[model samples]
Target chain A: MDLEDLYRILRTGHVQAQGIVDTVPDPMLVLDSALTVQSANRAFFRTFAVDRYDTIGQHLYDLGNGQWDIPELRRLLGEVIPKSSAVIDYKVEHDFPHIGKKIMLLTARTVFNPDNVSHLMLLSIVDITDRSRKEAEFEAVFGELRHRLKNVLGLVRALANQTKAEGVSGEEYRTAFLGRLQAVADANDLALSDHGDDSLDALVARATKPFQTAPETIIVEPSPPLTLASKEIMSLSLLLHELATNAVKYGALSAPAGTVRIRWEVEQGDHPLLRLSWRESGGPPVRKPASTGYGTQLIQFAIAYNLGGNVEQNYRTEGFEAEIVVPLERAARPD
Target chain B: MQKTILIVEDEFIIAMDLKVILERLGWRVLGPVPKVANALRLLEDELPTLALLDVNLGDQLVTPVAEALRSRGVPFAVASAYDKPELIGGAVLAGVPNAGKPTSEWSLLEVLAKLSPP
Candidate 1:
């Protein structure tokens, strides 16, 4: 072939090589034998917020806030490029003079020239900072899920132990246990809203929701925001369930003209505490039970033990009276 | 007159088991009635020798009924999953004693039999 024809062939080969470099999805840099960056593709510019035009002949470390000055990265490029292909992942942080903030992922490899004489290093960078951050968040959620399940199982074991009879079959026991657990879960669901925990407003509302079936049977007083802990919220929820259940059967909810008043306030001043009460009247004459059952125990447990508070349950002539006094610090903040 | 015991339990299956145990012991046994109101109404008409009560009835507390039994001088025992005993004045409870739940048939009847046999 003529020399001019050979020159044209050589020029076409260069164009084809450049075309291959430009089409890659990941950011890349082509460095000469001296390790000076010869060219940067468009993806490199977009990925790293750099100018492809300015990268020509610049050293890799001189660009983009000198993030490449990391000793690890330099060592990787120095020793790793001469032997077999080296793979690495590293995060480089840089602030764009114009763009707010930026993070980058860098991968690089050495390339041999045609005839295997000279060398060139090609860096392939995939920005993965966002993906890594989301992955971390997902792991935290899974951890919390595992913890919650453990707590539920622990409570079920306690319930099973305290029940006097191995009376129900495994299937039936599971169903019944689920029933109560669902009730408690519902209470927790209401108490724990979009946020991780409930605000005082939401917690009271949660306690009052189920009783709304017989509206006005239970009264709730306005109180300030006091974060209730999960344990306190669950205990209080169970108390409301028992009280409302009683109201439905014999107390205010039992009669058309009957009414119940429920109110709460975080006692302030020197000693901050919480006081709540359930007062029922107008349904039937209050008398003591022939035996104590789960409800009574739960009420007592809620007020006296869980909240570390005072409880007074009085079987008055007209209706039943219940009071709970708890310390304010026992509250939970919503997520 | 034979000693009679009335059973008030919220759980149906639980009440049935207790019935078998109480009847096997030669006690004149009435219903395994499942609610506070029903038990109270029944007792208002005919008093039993003793009662076995469960406090939380899913929708009510049977504490008032316990009080009614105390006023009428009838003895009773408690069977429940909850560990508290405020309704029976801890003293009376110590004598009759509540059987904390998930108990076997043997333990259940044993507790029932020990309840001041007439």
Candidate 2:
């Protein structure tokens, strides 16, 4: 009723309001009609890395050496708030000296003080830098996947055209085309199945699994555990497929008594190299072909060009042999 | 004389098929080189009437080879799965002909026709 009594009530209300603002989790600020910050919550200081002394009574755009002076932020606070009485999700991206680049979402509402009939703005800031970064990374990964898919499809189209043009019978072309596509599909499946690198033995087994009549017929020599990158796995798998296909038609696997032996070792040095050998024995006496075929070109390309390695195919009188030496760095295993 | 065309693609199957299509069309096919280094070497040793280049060569871009072919005045067309101009460096490939990936034989021939020597 009296002047002193009214003053006490006002002081208590102010303290209560300040305590409530400090308890809020998101950064918040109270600004007068002039757009000068009258009060800030504890979160405001922590989120922006500024002290109350530097923030209070300062223009919102002038805080932290003008790091808060974002063009989008200015439009939201200046035009949007005045017209609409509120703004939601006003995004601002700025490079702050202390915290680097950050993405912030701001929401603001106009509040009127009944006693003075003056308008005040209540602003809240949400730091969305981490979420925005993760979203961008996910988009990039998806884009890469789409690009790779397109390339794979392109390869498939080319394969079909080449097979059809080879003058092979329709059935033969169909079989051969499907076989090549399956090889590609198998490699892709292996790459996506597990995040960890694939073992060399696993790769060989997968490639040769479809061609083998019995496990013991095609001997895979015991070798140390070695892992290969996904790209290397795909190339090597396709390479082995071509080799096994040749063996099935004309090499060791064509005959019951014939045998094929695959062995590999890692030569450790300044740059580690994987030395792999494929040897066939006891087949019909072998002779080098006069002309190169698509299969031969594929093998050479996969090993030499794709793997950044060297491949030598020697058709000895007794059997056929292929030796491959590839750099370890290019085909690194997951540590 | 049959025109000799060189192909520089990283994918083995694609390169092999391109060779077949070109040969069927009565063109002599030269090195379907898969690496930038190999492609550059082949370009220096043998000159083909035209070249078809894949923009991405495994871990490397084919821009340097493109630049080389440009300097030699060798007409070539770029083949890539990437349609985004920026991804393939728009400025570098502004005037170069492009054949989008998954290109049919007809599409490939169309682009090659554009680069055929007069």
Candidate 3:
């Protein structure tokens, strides 16, 4: 070939190679044996936030104020590539002053010239910061889920032991334990439901639905919509279950003519408060129990401690009445 | 004097069950104290022969009480639902006896028998 033709062909090949390098999406660098940057791709300058003037001909460790001087990088380039001719997925994690924290995976290979002597190293960098962050977040979530499951299982075991300790018949224990477990399950379902936050009315309805024998026997008065926090739903469900169990056994729902009225009202002030009442009538004459039972203690504890509320029950001859006053900040959604 | 075993558990039902089991075993059960502060307070007033600790008390870890018992040369066992290696770490907790939760009566008694004073 003529000299002019050869020169044009060589120039075109060089431009084509440069174009391919510049067009590559991943950050890339070509460095000589001395670790001085001979050339870099467009992505390299953009990804590292350095101008071409600041990068070309600069030492790899000196650029970007030594941000690229990672020990892992040094090891891969200094030792690994020399022995293996290439290295892949050499990970480096660092907190750069310009980019905060980043995780990068590097693949490097040595390139040789026509003389069969190694001329330069081609290094490709993949920014895997987001992927690594998502992986870490998934691990944390999985760990938290495991922790919660363990705690729930522990609580269930405690419940089973306490139920057995009541000295009731096997059938009675099964019935009571199943009911308590259902209450817990219901609360969990409500918490994980699509709404995330459930209304107080809906919670009461769900808790008392299984106990209702006939319609209108339990009258729920319409009240202002008050959303309950996810944490409060479980305790409130258990409290309602206890109250309903009492009504069914001895208070109001025991008789055909008995009626139970549940009503609530919100009082707004410097600190809002929700006052809920459970009044029973038309059943057998109510008398104060000789001593509080475990159910009573659980209900009172749930109200007083879990909801940060006060519970007062008065045993009158007509019926049983219980009132609960809860701080809105603890149970209610903010306006 | 009967050897006393201090119980630190947050769950009331679990505490009651542990109290019953320990008492039935002929040991005087001390505080089944629910809170770390209350347990620490009990420690100030009385020194039990041994202690049974639950690793998690609501939001607080039982590390402080564990550390206190270790410094005082008091023998103790941890009863928790969490995996021992994952939840319990550090040089202080190395080799401390652990009873996994939903703990069988036999395992609990075995650990207690080991800790009981001769």
Candidate 4:
């Protein structure tokens, strides 16, 4: 072919190559043997927020005020690329200006002409920052789940060891221990359910469901929309379970005419407080025990220790009543 | 000596049970405080012969309490369900005695033996 015809064909081929590289989704750059940028695709400019004027003909290390001058990247290009025809999936983590910290996967391929002389290197960058961040978050959540499971098992063991066996038969002891365990499991299921809905009403309903002989036996008054953290939900579940268990054996739920009314409201003060009341009526006469039992201490500790709340119980001949007042910030999950 | 010991555990049942066990084991028990603030407050006025600390206390870690006890020269051991060091991350807890949870009586005695001198 004549020189003019050959020149036109080479120019057309170069433009077609440029078009194909620009279409690639990942940012790409063509570098000379000296590692200076000869060309960069549209994605390279868009992803790094740089223009062709500053990017073209600039040393790869000098681009964007030396943000790309990463030690790992340097080693990949300087040492690894020289020995191999292509370096694939060279992971580089760096803090880039205006882009924040980024985890990137780079692929560098040596380009050779017909004479088999390598004159250029093709570098493509895939930003895996978001993917890595999501992975880290997933790992944190999994660790938390594992930690919580261990704690639950530990708590169950503690419960078994502490369960009173003085006068109660084996069956009675088993029933008591299993009832408490059921309460804990129910609260956990509600807390960790896919929807993650831990509303006060839902917790009360779940904790009291097993004790409810009929739906009407237990009455829950309409309360404000309040969601609690997982710990708070667990504590509240135990508190409710103890109250219902007592009522079932000795209080309101034991009598057909008996009923328990549960209500809660937020009291606004210097610091907001959640006031929850459990009142029972229509059962046998109620009297305070001479000595506190496991149920009593569990109820007290579940409120005072776990929730940083206050519990006031009054054993009146008419019925048994308890009012719990917890700091609103601890009771309601902060938005 | 009175052989007094401090218990810094958050879980109510565990704390109460530990208190009973320690008492039965013939050691005088101080507050079974659940929060870091409570533990720090108790440390202000009283120093026990030894302490048992739970790694996670509701929302707070036991790092501050560990630091306080360390600075006070009071020996303590960690009680955690998590066995991994990274999971129970804290520079203060490195090489500290760990009494893993669901702790048996023998394990408790072993941890106590490590913290106290004969």
Assess every candidate by TM-score. Answer: 0.57, 0.82, 0.82, 0.84
Per-residue CA lDDT of model 3 for B3-96, tens digit only, reads 8988987655567667767788888988877777887898999889999888877667788888888889889988876565324434565566
Q: Is candidate 1 or candidate 4 better by DockQ?
A: 4
The true-versus-predicted C-alpha distance at residue A219 of model 1, in Å, is: 5.1
Better structure of 3 and 4 per lDDT: 4
Index of the highest-DockQ prediction: 4
Off by over 4 Å in 1: A1-25, A42-54, A59-71, A85-106, A127-130, A163-179, A195-229, A247-258, A290-292, A330-335, B1-118
Q: List TM-score (chain A only) for every prediction.
A: 0.71, 0.77, 0.83, 0.79
Q: Candidate 2, clashing residue pairs?
A: none
C-alpha lDDT of all candidate models, in order: 0.68, 0.83, 0.81, 0.87
lDDT (10s digit) by residue, model 1, range B49-105: 888877565447777778788889988877755455554233444445566564455
Interface RMSD of each: 12.0, 1.7, 3.0, 1.2
Runs off by more than 4 Å, candidate 3? A1-24, A65-72, A95-97, A114-116, A164-171, A192-194, A222-231, A264-275, A287-293, A301-313, A324-335, B1-3, B11-31, B71-73, B84-94
Error of 1 at B50 (Å): 41
Model 3 local distance difference test score:
0.81
The native-contact fractions of the candidates, in order shown, are 0.00, 0.87, 0.29, 0.79
Give every collision pair in model 3: none
TM-score of chain B of each: 0.82, 0.90, 0.89, 0.94
Q: Kindly state the number of residue pairs that clash in model 3.
A: 0
Q: Model 4 over residues A216-327: C-alpha lDDT tens digits?
A: 8999988877888777788888899999999999898999989999999877767878889999999999988889888988889888986789899999899999999888
A32-53 in candidate 3: lDDT tens per residue? 9889998899998888788999
What iRMS does model 2 reach? Answer: 1.7
Q: A1-335 in candidate 1: lDDT tens per residue?
A: 99999999999998887789889987888887777898778887887667766677788888766655667567667777666665666566545565545566767777677897888878877776678778899977875565355445435544554444466577865754554565577656865576744555666666567667665656666655667766566767667766776677667678777878877777675557777777888877878777876657756665554245777888897988888887755244322
